[model samples]
Target: MALTNSQYETIMREYEDRQTASRHLLEERTAEVYARVEGYRGLCESVASLSVSQGRKFLDGDEKALEDLHASLSSLSAQKKYLLRQAGYPDDYLTPVYNCPKCRDTGYVDGSKCHCFKQAIIDLLYEQSGIREQLESENWSTLSYDYYQGDDLQRFQNAVKECKNFIKTFDSDYHNLFFYGTVGTGKSFLSGCIARELIESGHSVIYFSAAGLFETLSRNMFDYKNKDDIVSFHEDLYGCDLLIIDDLGTEYTSNVAVSVFFSLLNQRHLNKKSTIISTNLSLEDLRNRYSDRVFSRITNQYTICKFTGTDIRMLKKRLQNRK
Candidate 1:
């Protein structure tokens, strides 16, 4: 979710482009109106003059200036509408249009990030989350108990219950989830279910495979020349509402990776932001790969759902081939 300066600039440049497009459109409409609508130019000029005069007169303590300006504007508006209709155009054709009416496509409203801007970020993250397509078919509503049995079924049901609770209370409190088990034991699928539900309800979510996460961290730590890129990447990792690190212990690990991972994990815990991590590594494997502190932190603070079952992906593929 952390953007390089160029990536950040790309989004800002889009906002600028939207404004420019809107302005050019208004200019074209104004020129068209002036050319086709007789007396429209004069009406616009009169309104402009009235606006300036009204502001100046009000500043000079003319108490009736605003009232007089309103009456004049209303009269001018009627004439303008009549002129546009005579020219076969709408009355408000010259009114400015914007991509985001709330922010005028400036990406900020009331000096905070606008809903449109936040949605833009969410869209970007959706593309990067890696589970976007899977979510469509893997959500809770599409889940089937037929795929599980015995101990696996019991564990799966329990995990679903816990995830539902997580979703229900997500706004009231903050918590993290750690999913560890055999490969294809429904870890990432359940994670995707949680992600889809929260995102549909308007929470910011960023997902990274362990490999992608470490690659980004390494790129920021050693490959980037600007320190701000490194800082911004860390800021993004810490700032999102939910961060999912999937397939842990599958990445190329080094000193830098371990350091960044531990730091990121610790900071998120301190900030009380929810995180969901799924890994094929067992508890003992995790302790051996990462430090005991990292293992201890997760075990102590996160709700653990241990998964055990046959590989569901292989089974599904085999079934598909049969069909």
Candidate 2:
């Protein structure tokens, strides 16, 4: 999803704060070292002067002067290192400390976003999703087989194993998953488990309920005023490592929604990105709701897992009431 202008400002402010803090820290440490080490302050001045002299000599095409200045600078550098060592400091202790060395805390490298920047965006998106609390309670660590019984239990166990296996060996070549079941049968929970695992492993994930997902797409596609938001919205939708559409068939499916949905599935499929769709709809329902081409792509490219059992939410409520 697209970040508002304020959100973008917040991220940029954070990056600026990091750089400012690093600079302040380096200045403080350098002052402390200079106070403790005699002659170090004078040594710094000499080094700065020599650097300026070297630059002028090169500009003047005086090779001999440049060579002498370089030698002097090298000797000064060695002396500085020796002094720092004697003062019980690392040789590079005065250098700026960056949270992300790749970007030097700027959030970009060579005009492209660094991994840390992408991570910041993912964090913001998760916060915006409003499902953080649900995910916290329903992730992999809390998943249990005690909620199932009989053949339902066996299928649940098998589904859990397959989900874990999917996370363990996940790669670009991995296929998507279709979790179809009645309400409260752990389909969305399993999707959350996989999302949590992959996100913790440094993958980008965007999870949306079917209605919310379609609404965002519809707004971006049709709203002229928020046209700028469309670019970032599309980028995250299509470019994230994994996309999870929970309760897929619950949206108000207009012609625009259906067309966009088809494009989303087709684009992600062609890009080899994985998607997990949890729907409380049967295969026949899916065929009726979506086009034949959409059904064909899903059946051909996705691992279909059919979930069956009593509603776990009701079971939990009954147990709680008994208590």
Candidate 3:
């Protein structure tokens, strides 16, 4: 869920517009109040003069003058409040109205991104990845045990329990999950279930097909034109709360892809970020395709879940045909 330059620019522009609009609104409200209230303008002028006089007195080491100016300013504030009350206006009618009080329309609080900014990123991610639509149909709420039979059913039940437990106790210490088996065996479905739950719980989740993942990295590695985009893409990959890579073995395994994959796995593991990978390749195949180092990391760091049985998609299709 990396934001492109355009998206970043759009968000910044919106923040600027919000600040401008709030200032304009405060000015307009103040102008209207000043025009209707006779002493309101004079009261504002007196308050400004008092502030300047207090600063000068403080610099000149005149403690008595500073104290007198403070009292005068307080009296002027009370008079302004009284005037506004008589004019049927609230005490803070001229205050700037911020959409997000935590950020004060700045999109950052104490130098970190505010909740509103994170929400904006999430919204942009949904638009780019279409994960919102997938989650609606594939989440745990929509999961059906009826899709599995006998041993497959038992495995599915265990996986569902494990997935739930993972979500329940999820933190930076949580282990990564490796869902591996034949095609259409619900590996991707189960990963989606975990992703949907974590995302709904306000955790950031990024999903990518293996091909898409590799393509992004490979393109960024070779294309020097969009260097900033490459940084943003990698930042999201390493920084998201959860990363899901579906159909891991389907990617074209170029040297660059393998190198990037290893770096991704190693960085996330060291950072204690959780990842869920669904692959049709077997453990033996994984070792053969990826290097021993990559295979070792997956084996050592991930909770391997093996899916087996007939293809659930085919079975569902058959049932539909019979009906």
C-alpha lDDT values of all predictions? 0.85, 0.84, 0.83
Candidate 3 clashes between residue pairs 3 or more apart in a chain or in different chains: none
Pairs that collide, model 1: none
| Model 3: per-residue Cα lDDT over 241-287, one tens digit each | 78899999898997778988999989998877899998999999999
C-alpha positional error of residue 25 in candidate 1 after TM-score superposition, expressed in Å: 1.3
Cα TM-score per model: 0.80, 0.69, 0.69
Number of the candidate with higher lDDT, 1 or 2? 1
By summed lDDT, the worst window of 10 consecutive residues in model 3 runs over 121-130
1 versus 3: better lDDT goes to: 1
Q: Best candidate per lDDT, number? A: 1
Worst 10 residues of 1 by lDDT: 1-10
5 Cα displacement, candidate 3 (Å): 16
